[model samples]
Target: MLPKCIGNLSTTLTAFSSGGNRVFGEIPEEIGNFVNLEVLFMNLNQLSGVIPSNLGNLRNLARLDLSDNNMGGTIPSSLGNLTKLIGLSLSGNNFRGQIPSQLSNCRSLDSLDLSSNNLGGAIPPQLIGLSSFAIILDLSRNHLTGVLPKEVGNLRALTALDISDNLLVGEVPSSLGACIGLTSLRMGGNFFHGSIPQSIRLLGGIEELDISRNNLSGQIPEFLAVLHSLKILNLSYNKFEGMLPREGVFKNVTSTFIIGNNELCGGLPEFHLPDCISKSSKSKKINIVILSTCIIFGVLGVAVILAFIYLCWLKKKVNKPVPSLINSSCPNISYGELLKATDSFSSTNLIGVGSCGSVYKGILKDSGIAVAVKVFHLVHHGALKSFTVECEALKTIKHRNLLKILTVCSSIDYQGNDFKAIVYEFMDNGSLERWLHPSATSSHGNELPKKLNFIRRISIAIGVASALDYLHHQCHFPILHCDLKPSNILLDAKMVVHLGDFGLAKFLLGSSHDTVANQMSSMGLRGSVGYAPPEYAMGCEVSREGDVYSYGILLLEMFTGLSPTDNRFGDNLTLHSFVAAALPERVLEVTDRIPLLARASVWESLVPMKCLKNG
Candidate 1:
């Protein structure tokens, strides 16, 4: 009794021609009586009982959906008799046991999502022939194991294929790269360890590639650097070694991206990691404290005062042994004329602020050259000595990564207020910290875009290190960047890095052995707490190792894509402590955000944090 057969047949009767009074119970096997039926859709009811094997009598049936009901037991083997069936969806019910492979003879399935169930065993490779031209394949989040067939490349028109979160292994078949139109590849978080094929990089149009958290080895092919169109690339926590690709997409990025893998090196100064110019140009701070006899030592406050005095001295000494912006005699612009051009110290034109004064983006009245004009704090009789020392030190030192102080402006305001200002080469990109976490400006989108990748991040680290190397070993006198942090390192138009804000501690102590250094061999106490070397905090002498610690923190930030103080880390976690926690094992726990997604897409689950700790 298949419902009521009297009202059930029409030539087009197909699946449900007659309502048959909507009796909610077991589908009667008698429905097989409809010999001319071409479609059957008896799903979503309280129907139960085995699908009658005799139902195959409907030779013309093209679609069958017996899903979402109380159906049970094995699929009727007679379903193989419906040679015309093109669509079959019996999912979401308590079907039991093995699927009869004989059904593959039907030869026409276009879309299938039979996931989220207990159906086990390897997907029969022969099923690829079932749909000669259909698309949309999804078999994710299941327990199915064994290697997927390389024969899948036969689906030349596949736009999207998701086979993630499974126990599948074996190399990602090179044949799949034949899908030239494929985009968004995720093959991370898996045990498919091997060098990636160059054919994948040959996919010129791919925008995002994640192959992190795996056992990949060998150098990242230089060819990958050619992916200029890529927006995010993740290859962290793998066994990649050697320097990063220094050309193509690797060359132009400025973000801190790579981390985890430790063998990577090279990337000399002026070397742009993949895309950034090398370590030769990235800025470094030199903290050389010269404790002086000055009173009112509120420490930070007095340091501020000392910085102000040296800045004044820095004016006359902008360039002595070092090259000056101009070779000619000092071009003096009267204070009155600069006052007028700056609109009487107007706040609107103000562009920056520093220890001793406010910086205004000003135009010189004499030559009309646009420059960043830093106006120091007011003139004081007692502070004049410290100011001169800064001017002189900045003048004698010369390096491409150091800021270029142009000239000074001095004059009296209408109220007889004494003013002094120094002009410098305008850094259009502002500070490194700002660029890394940029605030959107009116002209450019704010927020540092995910432009940095493994190669570029390494380049940035090396560049900063190189700068510090020069200060510690290459300079006439050793200098320590007492205040090293992301905020003070600056970036330029081409994403080249530069050092700014030279501290004046050595100046307040009056120069020479009286200063922090006795000459070129000075090992002084200078640096900020967060990035300061451990020994320095313990009252031991500072070393390049302190700068190295800061650089390490900076490196961790780039790789983890998290700040040193993010909640993701425990309370005692500095970037060092956090990274150390993830080290020797469990390193997969640290990843750039973009790569994490890629790893999950291309691999199994979040790589077991156990890999980091146990392996």
Candidate 2:
């Protein structure tokens, strides 16, 4: 017996199970006092009498199982109160009377089994139409009567259904075809009559079908042979007649079992069935004439369909607009047009080499709009993937600090080889790398030595930070800039920084709180050697913290005018250590003298000597 003292525990208890035990006698009424219980299992026991109606108090209950017991009585209608119940099983018991229509209130029920009981009365139409019944619905070996409800079609996700061995009458509901996912259907040992519905052909995924021992009449459908997934079909002890189909699963004798149908004949020779005799000559002539007429009409229909399709294709070609870019709202340019604008990719038009490809300066012939075209080298590893990633990243993101893609070209070149490129608004001032370390020999006639003041450097840093912040927090998906260095940062005519080069970008699928260990990456280590985080070398996953480390290094390089890759630092000394050692006393020793002297007055106002002395 369930101890009455068990109910004395705290109301916080959420589960109580006493199944498969020798425990007997009436369940103590106090058992229902655990109002907070969400799961109550007392199956496989000898507990008798009706289920406690007070169980309705568990409004938060999600599962209740009481099968294989000696309990006798009508199912408690109070179970309807479990609005959150996802599974309810009360099969293999002595419970009788009509199934409670109140069960329809369990809108969350996915699996329900009330089989092997003495349940009587018509099956509730509301219960049959419960859309949440996705897993299984077993009401077999019951005493249910009357026609099967048409509402059974509502179980679109149900995989298995067993309503066999019942007292149900009338034809099986044709709407059962709506259960397209059904893998097994058992309706045997019933009083169902009439020919099997033609809609049964729609159960293309059915693997097992049992409709034996029924009052069903008419010839077995030839369409049954075409259900490729069917493995076992049992039509024994039925009133089906006529010759059996010889194709598909029907050809295998062991897979199909049909017995006690005396009128059936002419199956495989293994069945030892009598041969079907030929019809009279007059009937043969009629069949030949019908077959010849059908062939003529079928040929004419095919020719007509082909001619109509050809006419539609010709019409579409004549009126089709010029081939444009992916986003049709923008101006369109073809591959040949871009090639001519770039002077056939001449060496004079070359701008710079990137991670995946080379950049070329070009001007549109009609509009004369200067643009930078990046052509990807398909043979290089990860080159195509980088182009695809960059395109996808730029399409959904837009900001003043982010590079804008004017258009893209995905077509064949003059030599018939594949070509892929992206065009973007030209940055006249070139990359931050060129600005920081000017080349002695200039290719472009307008090339001039450029320098950034202290204030300009701060503004550029703020712009890059704003772009990174948007990518990490504001977007629908977080984007990680795997590479963050001076070369990837561009400056326009006004010296406004624009973050570009998303070739190695990664979009995180998880939330911000997820640990770096849980993140995934196909590229091994990210960022350049000195700028990359220390954890990256250890094969640890990448995170936003890695980007912050790179930014910190970049900031240090800006003020010190020393690259992290400079040969001055060797085994023991790094850029970080070098900057750390030169603190308050020797700070000006490592500073960039040219820019520092130009902004001396601003530096004095920004950083007082007293603050450095106190530190």
Candidate 3:
């Protein structure tokens, strides 16, 4: 609730901010009297009701942010009156109806965000395609539909543009390539079709690009590999085909994602795809026609004999039993060794418990090396299968940030009962869950502190991102850790992250990112409550997007020191919404006190105050 008395300061006040508070109620129309105000921020609050049209009266306002509120109704066309405005953010709200085309009048504006709202209808070409945006222009996660106008090329100074997760249709315009300054471009999760525009080759400085989960078809462009500045690329779940180029970004398997394109073949050996048939091979086969008739007949006779021999070999293979594990290279450890290491599964050694099993801390008898032994409860419905799936996932992928499997044991115990366990290098720092909520979950004698500082949290996040990037792109078969939570994130003595727990992991079959090899066998909810994406609860199949959603929640929890299942969260309010309500301005208030105590001025220093004032 802003006080109406503040209006009296309209002539003297240069800036006013009431963001990231629990303030509610409509903004008083008297606020429009602030003719001298240069900056106004009321974001991340509970404010309801329509925006006051009178706000446009602030001709001097250079920066305005009223995002992440409950404000609804059409955006006032009066906003176009702020011809001097440079930045405007009205995202994550209930605002509905078409965007006002009159906004194009803000000729000086360089940054704008209208994402994550109910705003629909065709994008106003005049407002977007004609703007001389220099920083960022994000209109994603809305219901907006229609073709992206070619006039968008006018924003040649823009560095980032995102229109993903919308209903946008039609081919991407070639004119978009004219925005050569763009470093990040995302147009995924749309209805876009046809080939990627050839003009994109002009965007030599582009770093990150995502156009996945669309109707896009055609061979992936070779120019993408030549874009040396390109670091992250996602072209999955489309209709791309033909040989994948082996140069530049394509050679770095971890940075590129291209699954769900069945016709694609021939890249690095890591992709495990069939060799591409060259034109020379076809010419050689046709040359056989020039051979003598007797030679052709002799070739047909040899083929028949080889076919019979192949049939006999196939018959022998059919009778052979299939091996349970895909990887047999792992050293086998017996039940006796595990019993000696874990002290006969002593309760004193138990460190953690999960859906499929319990983890025990142990030291190998011979090497005296510390390890964490995960012993599955075979009595549990899916425990045996979970063990097998984990083993296969671990053996197939190797990454620095991923937990390393030391050995595995699969044999009968003294009671003649089945025993299965996996050994991993012990993480001395323990799970991220313990550190984030130390008071609630930390074990006695745990030496780690309750709060992680700013630099530490960022490092952990980067480590986790690297591990996920490898699993989703670099692996021969993309793996989805259906369950990603703070508990699954471990840290070593050096505080480096190690992502563990693959009990519910799913392997994408063939080249389809959405089709799992054993989906039916692992049916039901795909992840832990609170962390799982909403679609999983609706019976949707597992997807890479789902893992990303869980990761987002985990990241929020890490910095906020609040769990997704925190008692404070309710039906409408979530960890996501709570954070959304206090971004940029109230960020420090919602942040875990640990980081702020270490350094309070970090975030404030990052704000581009010069741009806000000069523009």
Candidate 4:
């Protein structure tokens, strides 16, 4: 016998699973005292008696599986109180009575199985309206009767629905066509009459459909031939007549069972059906003539329209004035060419957005070269200046670690806007920001955590350093990169870092004027917050030393996995101060463990001491 003292352990219990135990006895009513229980699985047991109504006290219960038990009683109406219930399986039991309509209150239910029970009465309309049923809803092998409700269409996300082996009657609901996500539907072994609904064609993703052993009478739907995703189809023991489709799943006689439908004719030779006789030979000839006439007229109409549109496009091209390139060193790509390449600057092509402009991924039609087009938003303050500075800075510099500028578009757009765009070689991989902080949701709705190895981090740091070294010392006129951050660092297919975004770049010229730097310095802050040095906050001129300060912070962020702008840092506590406290001993605590593990061999030999000393 189960201990009644189970209620004493209920206060802290979140789960009580004793599945497949074959525990013979009535489930202790005290089991319901577990108010915090989220999962209660006692399946494959010989437990009997009424399910404790007190189980409803578990408001957090997400799953309650009591299948394969000898429990014989009405499902507790109080169970409906579990609003967070995602799965409720009471199958393979002797429970008898109408399924509680109160179960409809479980709005989060993804799977609900009450099969192999003595459940009778009309299927609950509220139960059929559960749109969250993305998994399975099996009520098969039961004494369920009456017409299937149109509310079944509300289960648009349902993948599988098995209501077979029941006493269900009346025509199949046409609203079932709204279940477009259904991959499997089983309504066989029932008394369903009338032709298959034409709306059934909407289930283009159906992989398995079993409507066998029904009173269904009509020609098989030809649209079934086009449901390419279908793998198994059973139309056996139905009253379906006429020719079976010879395409798609129907072509495979073994996978598609259509036995006992005596009137059915003309399918794949493997089906061994009687040949379909042609009855309207004269009408068929007239129909063919009409179709041929329509085809000729349709072809002629399409050709004329296409020719007129092409002529209009050519005339517009001839009238449009071509914009000149900013410099002879780079290619001269027109605004129209780029507009066509990026689908007129569609949001889908947009890759990144900054204070001054948005970057779009484009492929030139003429050369088939993939490029990144940085289009300046002229409406923003200092945007035009950023554009000019970038063009001037990029034209003078050339380095492996630097972003390669392919061309510059200083032109007016079709909308008569002051459009200025700079084109660069497209980076196959995205920015370092994404790698540093990967999102929980992806395009495919999967959690993808991006990991950067120690070696790759070192390589990126080295590449950025090389680009900075070139700008500060190797350039004809030393340039100061005012803004240097992870977002500005782009990676290629080989993971080679390209230091980009020279919008705030200042050229250091040995002159008395100090015009550009002086004007930019007056803007208060030069670079991103936390990245701009402390001196910059005091209205100091942007310099290579400031770049070095930002670089130090960037390096700290890469290794320690703590952003300088993280909420933890404040007035007294800075990223530098935080790291200083951790020092050489507690450095392991501050840094990311994953990369540290990857570079374990080099930690003592190369990284720790040097990073501590420099960082």
Say which candidate scores most in TM-score: 3
Error of 4 at 123 (Å): 0.4
Evaluate model 3: give its lDDT.
0.84
Task: Give the per-residue lDDT digits (tens) of candidate 1, residues 568-614.
Answer: 65667667777787785677777775556554443445466666446
The lDDT values for all models are: 0.57, 0.80, 0.84, 0.83
Predicted candidate 2 versus true structure: per-residue lDDT over 363-473, tens digit per residue? 877666788889998656556556656765675578889888888776668887657788888898888877666663255668777677888888988999998998888
Every model's TM-score:
0.37, 0.46, 0.49, 0.46
Residue 510, model 4: lDDT of: 68
Residue 277 in model 2: lDDT = 48
Off by over 4 Å in 4: 280-615
Question: Predicted candidate 3: what Cα RMSD to the true structure?
Answer: 22.4
Q: Residues 508-533, candidate 4, lDDT per residue (tens digit)?
A: 86642221232233234789999999
Question: What are the per-residue Cα lDDT tens digits for candidate 3 across 268-378?
Answer: 989776788899997887776656556788888999999999989888889654433212344578889888988988998998999889999987786777789999986
Better of 1 and 2 by lDDT: 2
Descending-TM-score candidate ranking: 3, 2, 4, 1
Model 3, position 89: C-alpha lDDT score: 98
RMSD to truth, every model: 33.2, 27.3, 22.4, 28.3
Better of 1 and 3 by lDDT: 3
Q: Tell me how candidate 1 scores on lDDT.
A: 0.57
List pairs with backbone clashes in candidate 2: none
